[model samples]
Target: MILFFGTRPGKTVITQLPDTACPYCNQIGTLQVSKTSSYFHLFWIKLFKITTDTIAECSHCKRVYYENEFTEAMRKELP
Candidate 1:
């Protein structure tokens, strides 16, 4: 018998931050937050979620910020 199991990324959820400025570009209302979940799968079927990651991106500068790189203002806007 053979088995196939692995982990895959789930759908991404995006949220717009109003009145929020990008930490790097300093552009207001251009910051968007994206949340993604990783799930464990067995035989192409998702079994359970492993972890979730949050990130912020600047539409102006195109910079991506991870959770560890989030600022105080950015943290407050997270849901």
Candidate 2:
């Protein structure tokens, strides 16, 4: 799935992902795949597989959101 790993303005660089516990998966690796940041106008999107970034598919919910997104939310929630 394509994830926003912090932007450089115009690019939406996407890394790849797989269906396993990220820590246990290890079946994937880093490969850079990107898109136009303009597309982010959609609040949520089904990211394109570019490379893995510690992201794993939930066996139950099967919902995918960036781990970074969750972390950022928690950081904001803390304050």
User: Which 10 consecutive residues of model 1 have the lowest summed lDDT?
Assistant: 17-26
- Which pairs clash inside model 1? none
CA lDDT scores, all candidates in order: 0.92, 0.35
Q: Residue 29 deviation, candidate 2, in Å?
A: 9.4
Any idea what lDDT model 1 has?
A: 0.92
**Number of clashing pairs, model 2?**
6
Leading candidate by TM-score: 1
Model 2 over residues 5-70: C-alpha lDDT tens digits? Answer: 421234444544332222332333322223333322223553343433333243344444444633
Candidate 2 — which residues are off by over 4 angstroms? 1-9, 18-62, 68-79
Residue-level error in angstroms, candidate 2, position 53: 14
